[model samples]
Structures are given as structure tokens and as C-alpha cells.
Target chain A: MSSHSTRRGVASVMTSSTYRPASAAEARFLAEYDASAYATPLVTVDPVIVTLRDEQLAVLLVKREEHPFLGSWGLPGGFIDIRNDADPEACAVRKLKEKAAFVSPYLEQVKTVGGRERDPRGWSLTVLFFALIAEDDVPPIDKRLAKWFPLSALPDAMAFDHRALIDCAIRRIRAKAEYTALPAHLLPQRFTLSKMQRVFELVLQRRLTAGAFRRRIEPLVEPIADCFETASHRPAQVYRLRPDSGSLIFEQPLKGARRK
Target chain B: MSSHSTRRGVASVMTSSTYRPASAAEARFLAEYDASAYATPLVTVDPVIVTLRDEQLAVLLVKREEHPFLGSWGLPGGFIDIRNDADPEACAVRKLKEKAAFVSPYLEQVKTVGGRERDPRGWSLTVLFFALIAEDDVPPIDKRLAKWFPLSALPDAMAFDHRALIDCAIRRIRAKAEYTALPAHLLPQRFTLSKMQRVFELVLQRRLTAGAFRRRIEPLVEPIADCFETASHRPAQVYRLRPDSGSLIFEQPLKGARRK
Candidate 1:
């Protein structure tokens, strides 16, 4: 193959013309560099709150009140308080409580999105986070402009790059669910196996054979003493994730290999 | 447990005293906000080049020539040229070529790490990337400042949070290798099964049985016509990754379930 075979040491790489260290004058210039020379983008934190509502996968969104897609729906988020919050995650938690008056049981830093004219308010960088809350735990919107939209059918336009952020969160959650206990975050403390199966189906956007799913998750969960009985249906077993299990990844072979 | 029950919408949240939007006057003030108003952290990108050398996992690092940890080894990286590069990934590829005269076959945006005091040059944010290169493809270092250090035994002193960055990359690569075919990136275009298995063992820090590994990868790779033979050893078969197997994730059950 076309591969370089030179086995030079670090000294040679560091002293080369392209990778040379800064001169004394250049070092001074960098040390005294005025950050205000160019407009620095405002860094913000945005979160996609995902939940199961009316048997549909939904996301929490808020209406933008200012210019640049004003009155359009967007993820519930705000500018991070750099002074008060310790990190981007802290900022996400604070913003969610302040703007949505909600707290998510599971929160994770998904990714960061910047550039591509994401915002009209000069240059901007946004750290995106995803939070999964149980449907029963979703509090009523404290404001008139916030609402839950189906993930599969979002509005035509959203504030900034909120649409892309939501899509990223959905894909990440689905991929993570395949291996992690992330779906547990979307279930109540006590849930029936059927209830959980429905949540899984909603999040994954596909139907799963109950027998296959149970076989797949048999070791991942433990049956509790409690049971849920409906008026029209018989008592179903209740289950909770095994306390010892921390992200149990079940590897299913590729489709092509299934023939074997 | 203690969950909020309010059903307010966006208007209520936005208009609330705690979550008010920036008013016209406040907007004007923010528009004119100067970088000197607060300590704005410098943003930089650092890359971790992981490879196998002499049957040991190693990473590329360079000695810092400046005052902060001068003469200490650190990941080869530099401040982002945002104007020239579209994103952090582009900046990482550029830095690698300049610093080591090396181009990786696979480069992925692993994660971003930032904190107030992460850098001695005031507050700083760093976007970290991990790249995988075959040992034979490593080019000669153009400068004398770069070197490869064993991952298990790095130097005592490193600049900034370089040590933590390296640890993060290792964990991510190891975890990813468990479910994804990322180990393929560490091997040459054409390699023997034994060579491929060794790369996996180095990254995962574990020994996998040859029969088990071969069965697991049977569908992932296809046999090639080439073979390597020596007087002391029989001809070893060669193989290559199948073109259709992109990011094949095999479901290996958790260890606790393996007993069953």
C-alpha cells in the first residue's frame, strides 16, 4: 500500500520548519493577545428533553420571543451563566430549571454545534445536551409558549439550529439504547414489562417481537414483587433494572451474519 | 419522587421573572460586550494518535518549548485557526500534518473537554480528537521535539490537561472496540488474522481466544489471496475487511450474563 515508512523521533518532528516553536517576540504577541480583536461567539447551552407522550416520542420546545425566528418553537434552553455554573452540564441543568421549570432524571452532553450561520445574533456556539424524563414525571408547561412536539413530525422552522440538535439527540438515544440502560430513564420507578416494551418501541421507532425482546433483556432486568393489574387485563409482572447492571450492551450480530 | 407538576407553556416561562429574555436595551448591551469584560478562555484542539509499536500501545506527544511545562511532553496540538479551518476536526488534521508529517487513516471527533483553569494561559476550552494509524504508515518526524511514549507508562509531566485527555481517548477507544469494528482502523489495508488480533488485544488490554475471535470476525472480514510463509512457521492466511461491513456492532452480552 501507499504508506510512509519513516520512523523519525519526536525531536525531528518538533524542530521542523512547519512545527517550530514561537519566537520570543511571537510568544509575547500571543501572551499579550487581545481576545477582543475579533468578535467572540457567545456560548450557550441547549437541551432536548425527550419523553413518551400519548404513546408517541416527544420533545419539549419553547417559543423564541426575540428576532431571528421569533415566535418559532425551539428546544428549551438559554445562555449559560458562566459565573454561576461550573461546566456545560451544570449550565444545562440550571437552564432547564429556569426556563422549563423541569428536571430530567437522565442528562448527558450529546455534542457541540457551531458555525454554518446557526444564529443571526452574530457568531454563536451552543453546547447541546439530551435529557430523558418519564412521561408521568413531565410537569405542565409553566409558560403558554412551551409545548411538546412529536419527534417524527417537527415544525417547519425552529429557532437557530435547534432542529439539528433534536435530531442528533434522537439518533444518539436510539444508538445508546441498543447497548446502554438509557431506556430505563424514560420509564417510571415502577413499570410493567408491557409498558416498558411500548416505551422501547416508541424510542426506537420500530416494533419488536415481545418474545425476542424478553429473551434479549432477561438478564438485564429483575422482576420486582409488585405487579400491575388492569380492569380488562390480567396481572402483569413488574420489573426494575438490576441494581448491579450498569450499561449492559447486548451485541446482536450483523444481518448478513444471521444466516450462519 | 419529588417532581414538578406545573403545566405552564413557553410564554409563561419566558415572561417569568426567572427566565426573562434580553430586552432591547439589554440586547444592545450584550452586543457591545467586550471580551475583556470577563476572562474569555482560549479555545484549542488536541489530537491523540494511537498506534501499536513493538507489541505495546503508544501515543504521539511533543515537548513544549514555552514556559508552562517547558521540556515536558504533551499531545501535539495548537490553538485553532478558526478562520482557515471550518471546524475543530479540520484543525486537528491540519495540526497533525504540521506537527508530525503524519496522516491517519481514521479520525473521529471523540469529545470536547473544557474547564475554567484547564490552561495556564487563562481560562481555556479544548476540543479533543483521537486518530488511529498503522505502525508501518508512521512518517519520520520532521522536528526533534516529537516522540512516541508507551500509553501504560507516560512521562510524569505533561502540559495542561494533556494526561487526562489521553486517558479519555483510551477509554473511548477501548469501549468502542467492544461493540464497533473500530480496530480495523489500526491495521494496514492487508493484514493477517494474527496481526489483526494483536491490534485488538493491545487496544482492549485483554487477550482474546483465537477461535472465539475468528468466529466473531468471520463475517466481518473476507479472506484474501495473499499469505505469509516462513521456514520456521507455516503459511498464515491474510484477510481484509469487507466493504459492506461499515461499523458492524456485534452484541456480546455482559459478563454477568455469560455464565448463564
Candidate 2:
């Protein structure tokens, strides 16, 4: 046995060093193993950047210039720099800015993908991140290699497990939209009721009756009381999301009569 | 530079192995890097086994017998065996069964914990699984030195960021219970409405009005006529969950009800 036990709390292996020591019994038990015996795995981060463009839901993707499935588009992602940031979410934000010039978006941890053979290079675990941005505010695609793709028409031939990653992200977003204020993150700071409804419609892939949708969202939003004059027949009322409300609203059932 | 370039089209990655090949230019760009330079990462699966015992929600934990936080208690977890099961969820279930001697509870992927230094062993990533088992059905506590601790009174010392892991799992369960039928997993196959309600109350840490809770749950259960034999006072009706119904129920709000 190598006498190096990673197991914690066993009393025998404790030693006097900066590295906490394991108990002697634990050290002896783990000594038979060697971390070097297995292949060193790579850690990467994948971002699911979502935006509402022209009332339609979209995801940001990059065109691949490398092999495997060359010329395919996918979410922008890369390896994590361990020394840079203490938090994975922070690393995700930093990477998005560096790779795609996106900043300060509504970002949350999605999940991690770690199938041994999912990646051809070696065993790797990619931390998945979901970010929401207004469609219009997205900076011009910086990486000539990357482009914005509508959620409905994603290009084929994504890299690695990026396709599965995107699928999970989209499903989560749609499911969450039903319960939380996540979709609001995709809209502008100030928007009309109809505009907000359109974002939901596009994400849900179904048309919500205008009257029903408005009634459903009435309590969730407080009217900003500002009028955004439209070129159409009537002026639309503008509204902003209520402040300090966390993601709990989605848990409440949608209010209003179902549109027949 | 290794000639094996893995980066390819984004969407095409979703398709099984028989897709198109990368172009020569794309291959050349990706092939330049030495994929072997980096070491493969360590991926582990940690099971957050939760059960309701003595009318309290508890988590099954093992006392660390080695270094790190020797003597501290934490969730039962182990390294994932990729060769045994293609799915991570399966591996998680396996670990719980083999290590904890428990089977077939409510299991779901909670989240992945991957921060540098989270584990003193080395760079490690853990896929957390949460399972809810009926307290009485749980096998005798593993004599090898594991214990069940109530959610309200977690031990002061725990191994490898498990305190945070448990906290995250609790929040996830609480949020999930509000919208999904997760609490049903904690009860027997056939249970009374009061039993079901108690499970919810314990997990939520709040008392729910019996009438309100029953109204909310009525649609979810299949009423068994003449099946109730009340123990005291009024014999409450007993119901069993409809096997075919999905765990989630989308409740559109009622007309004229307060939205919030």
C-alpha cells in the first residue's frame, strides 16, 4: 500500500503538515491506490447562452474550425483555468467574456457532463452553464467562428456532447420558464406586455391566447406606468419586473382561465 | 500536436456515431494540439440518501474514519465506475444500494460539485444524487460507522464540502416539492392523505392546512372508494397515486383568484 489515504476522518493517518493527514488505517487502506494509475481528466466549461431576438428565443453558438465534425456550430466553451477564479460561475462568466465578449448576463449552473467516452480525447467533465441575455443587446458575434442560431433551427454536427448539453439546457429553460421569471431575463429592461408574451410563446413553442397570457402575468409584473407609443393602432403600456422577487413565482400555478 | 482534432459541428454532435466527417482544413486546425498534455480528471458520484424517520427528515451519513475532517459525518458517496454502467444515474443508484444497503427510492440528479480544493485528494468532480426512502424501510444503519442525522441538526464537522452539498440538496428538494410530486416518494406505495401531507410538512418545515393540502392533492390521487378505515374520530378517505400520471402536474391558475 502507498500509505496515502484520501479518505477523511479515519484517525490513524493524521500527520503534522499543511495538508490534512488521514488516519493510519485510512492511509493504509488507500495506500494501495495511485491517482497516477488512471488517466488525468480534463475539466471544461460549456455555456448555454440564451437570448430573445425579435421576440423569438435564440442561443449563441460558434462554428467549429477543427476536426471531428468540422464546420458545425455549437455553444462557445473551453477549458477552465483553475487559478483564475474561485467560483465556477465566475469562471463561466469570465470565459464567456473572453470567448464571446458577453458580460453581466443572468447566468446559473446547469449540470455537468462526464461520460467516460463522451469526449474522444480523454475522460473529461464539462460544467454546463446557462446564461440569459436580451437578443438585441448581444454584442456582434465576436469570434468570426461563432454565430447566433434560433432555438428552432440549430445546425447539425455539434462538437463533443455539446448537442446533448444544448438539449438539456433548452429543456431546463422551457420547464423553468413555466415556474420562474427566467424568461424575463431574455427580454429588455423595459418591454410591452405583448413583447413579453411573445418570448414565452417562442420558448414554449405554442401560442398563448393574448388575453389569457396577459391575465396570467398581471400579478407577476407591476405596470411601469410608462407609455411606449407604438406606430400601430394603440399605445402599449410598458412595465418592469418587480424588484427583489426571487425565482419562487414559477412554483405558483399560472393564474387565469384556460383559453379554449 | 496530436493529429486527432475532436471539435466539430455543434448540432451534429447530437446524432449518434454515423454522422458526416470533418473537412481536411478543420482537421488540420484541431490536430495541432497535444491532447495528451493534460491529465484526465477524476469523476466521482456522491449519493445524498434522504429518508423520513421518526417524523423527521434525515440524511444517511458516514463518519469519516480518516484525515481531512476525521470523525466528521457526511453523505454516502464513492467514485463512479464508468465500465459498469453507461448512465451516471445508474452508477449512483448502484453505489447507494451497495454502500448504503438501500434501494429504489426517489432518485434524481441534484447538481455537480466541482471547485478546486473541494477535495483534498486532488482535482475531483462529484455528481450528487438525492434519494428519498421511507424511514422504516431503511436497512439497519451500517455498523461500519454511518449515522442518520436530521436535516435540522447537521453535524458540526463533515468531509469535503458535504455541508454545502446537503444544504443545496435540501433547497432543491424544497423547491421541487412545491411544484412536483417528489414527496410521494417518501411515503409507502399506498398511503392516506394525512400521511402524504405529513411528508410534505416535514420536508417543507411548515404546517399546511389539511383542507388546502387535500384540495391541492385531490386531482393527483386515485380515490379508492370504501378503502378508508379511520383510526380515530372521522375515518379519512385513503388514496393511492395513479401509476401512469407523471410526477409533475401543471396547474393553470383559477379564474378570479389572487395571482400571488
Candidate 3:
């Protein structure tokens, strides 16, 4: 069982990854390759678009109109144009462009979901992406029955294992929240520490000790002069992500439990 | 556009990810679906099998025998037998079973690499996996020009975009090495701390301060009291991963630089 017997060939190679005609033989092989001869899988890129909605984490979903999972909710995603998409990232960018008007500072790949039984349309694979966008940036996507479901209240009638994909995305974002300033992206420009703590708690689904949370977040944020009036306590100082602090990695994971 | 228009539908959904006939129309659509009508892309799973050789990190590659790559080196992987492979992980495991004789405890999906132009045959995508196996555990397969190349010096003639894939795998391994006992899998069970330090350095491509390295690793490993004789220094105690510790994640990354 050699490696050659294992694959439907992709391309020729030379001094690098860029495709170059290695020889006349390889060129002939590409010309003669019958992609239709074999059973190829349907591939797609689905983004789990995340945002803060009414003090809770929500993901955007659209109701399908056609066959297979008609009326079932799905993440906003689709196939590569082939004529337009240069690569997966380009396809991801294009998918974002199609969904809403705003751009997110964080759009990262989570993982690939694939299997034979996962999709009824034959073997299928989907690359899952985690995108964090502001809630106000997205206008209603024309009358396609789009809605935001809170993380704790996802719909039961989900399409094509997309529920699992959203779960995977939440786990990834939570992991990032443990050691980086990822949750800050979900907040406004100048927010109170109390609001920031609530956002972290919302994403992580746990409460953090106020003292430890402040200590860990102090280096990542800088206080502003303007204060946000608090309901009960005195006016709290506002803070923003430090200038040039891109995805700041903290020294430790935030242990949400309070210390003795 | 709606999500239904974005994809070639996978399947019908219900109260869960499992496929079920949500409506009579959905069942009818599945029965009449024609997979051969469209130009679907080729999807494959490639594992970056990694280990240590001669005090340097190495990856196993096989020279291709077929047309697209011909004689160029490739990561030992192939297409999924949709009939047999229940999921992508199973496909990766089957590829490992075909290559050599070893089972790695750590087999993880890194990311998905996809594009239309990447593979000259047609639109192609591969799910990249990171597999860590001990070098000694692998015996030679039926001789087909299989060889191990150190990470620093890979073949210039690589098949597809495998060179980029290899680089991505290395970056992942190095990131884990900073805060985990991942590189320990590259070492023998009852190895010395000195050997562990070397393995980390090999994977990270940087020198580490011995004291700081030991301080970070102490909680992860338990001394067995068996000593490994050194050439110059007194015999060092052998250590293994803590019994209850599955994958030890340290509080901070190992700063490789020495202190004043």
C-alpha cells in the first residue's frame, strides 16, 4: 500500500508549493485527469458568526428554503465560487461579505467537520470558522428569516450538524478567553470593568473572582478619563484595549472560582 | 442569498444532528438526489506524522509513484474510502495503519487547507492532522522510498502544497511545546530531564535556560528513582508523565532565553 494508491492526485511540484510543470509527463496527467470519474465530496466553509445580543452570546442563523433541510436553521455559509475564491480564507472572506455589512477583527478557523454519515448528499466536509462581530454592525439580511439565537437557547431543528459546529466554535472562543483578551472584542470601545467582567462570564459561562479578574485584566486594558455612571456604585472609570495590544496572551488561565 | 442557495444540501435535520425525515418532501429529495450531476471537489485527509531523529525533529515522507507528483516526496496520506471511513479521523487512522506499524496517542486535527487552484486536477481540499509517534515504534514498510527528513531541511520537491502543510504542523507543535508535555511523546518513557530539554529545544528551534525549563516541567513529570547515567555529570533521575495528568498545561510558556 504505497502513498500513490491512496489519493486522487492534486498537482505537480518543484522547488516549492507553487504549482510548476515538473515535466511533460505531469502536464499530461493533469490534462487527462477525469475528476468526474470518481465520487467527489461536497465541500463547504461554514462560519459560526458570534456577537453579544442583549447581554448574552448569540450566533446568527438562517432558515433554509430549499430541499434537504427546508426551514431548518443553519450557519451562514456556502461553497467556493471557484471562479472567485482564491483560497479557503478568500472564500471565508467572501462568505462574510455576503452575510452582513460589518467586518470583525477576529475571524479564525476552528476545525473541519467531516464524515460519510454526517451528510446525506454523499460524503461531505465543512471547514468551521469563528468570527466575532459587533451586534449593531449587522443589519437584517433581507427577508430570509434570519435570527440570533442565544448560546444557551439554540434551536432544536438545526441543519446538517451545524449545532455541533457551533458548540466547537464556543469551545474555541472560551479557550481563547481563558488566556487572551478575546472577549474584549465583544464589548464597546470604552466599557466599565463590571461590564467587561460580565462579558467574560457570559462567554465562559462561569463567575470569576473580582480581584483576580481585575489583576489579570489590568495589564491588558488602560483606563480612560471619562467615567461610566454606575447604577449603585460610584461612577466607574472606563477602559479600552491597550494601544497596539493585539490578542494579548496572559500568563495564566483565569480560574473562575474565587480564592479563599 | 439564503444558506440553501449557498450549498449543495447535505441532509435533513430534526431535534438533533442525526438525519431524520423532517417532512415527506425532504425524504423525496434525498431519494431523487443525483450526486454525479455536479462537479464536486476532491477531499482527502493528510496526517503530519512527527517524531525525533538524531536530536532533531523529523517528519516521515514517501516518494510518489503516480502522475501528479511522480517522484516527488509527499506526506503519507490519501483519499477517504467513503464506504469504510465513518469520519475523517477514521480515514487518518486507516492511513496510519497502511504506512507503518505504530499507534500514536496524540492524533489531532490541525486545520483545513482548501482552494480551487491548489490542485490542478480540480477544486481540492485536505484536512491536516498532527500525529506524534515514537520513531522506534515504526518499522520499515514494504520498501517504497520512504525516508525521514529533519524539520530544518525538507525536500525542495514536494507534492501538492505539502511543504506549507509541514510548516503549519511544526508551528503547532512548537506552540504546544511552550506550555505542554507534548514533546515528551518524542522521548522514551523513562527518560532524563536533560533529554526532555533537548527535545523541546529541537521542536522549538531555540535554546532554553535549564533552570527555568526544569521549574516549568517539574509538576508534569514524576521521578522514578531510576537514574540515567550521563557522560560528564552524575547520573540524572529518570522521569515520566504524572500518572493522573493526561496532558499537562503549565501556567506560563517556557521563555527559552537565559536570565542574568
Docking class of 1: incorrect
- Regarding TM-score, does 1 or 3 come out ahead? 3
In candidate 2 chain A, where is summed lDDT lowest over 10 consecutive residues? A1-10
Ranking by DockQ: 3, 2, 1
Rate residue A260 of model 1 by lDDT: 22
Across A1-260, the per-residue lDDT of candidate 2 in tens digits comes to: 11112223322222212345456655653444333343333567789988876556678887755455556676677665443444466667776776567664767888877655666533456789888887667777675656778777887657888889988998988877776767877777788888888787777777767776776577667777665748669988888777755553653544333568
Ten contiguous residues with the weakest lDDT in model 3 chain A: A1-10
Local accuracy by lDDT, each model? 0.67, 0.66, 0.73
Segments in model 2 whose C-alpha atoms lie over 4 Å from true places: A1-37, A248-251, A255-260, B1-36, B39-41, B83-85, B250-260
Tell me the deviation in Å of residue A32 in model 2: 13
- Compute the lDDT of residue B91 as modeled in candidate 3: 77
lDDT string, candidate 2, B129-232, tens digits: 78888766677766676678887788887788888898888899887777677777788767888888888888877777777677777777887888885786
By DockQ, the best candidate is 3
Task: Compute the lDDT of residue A171 as modeled in candidate 1.
Answer: 93
Ranking by TM-score: 3, 2, 1
Q: Per-residue CA lDDT of candidate 1, range A68-156, in tens?
A: 45678888776644345556677777777766677654678787665525654433467788888888888777677577898778999
TM-score per prediction, in order, is 0.81, 0.82, 0.86
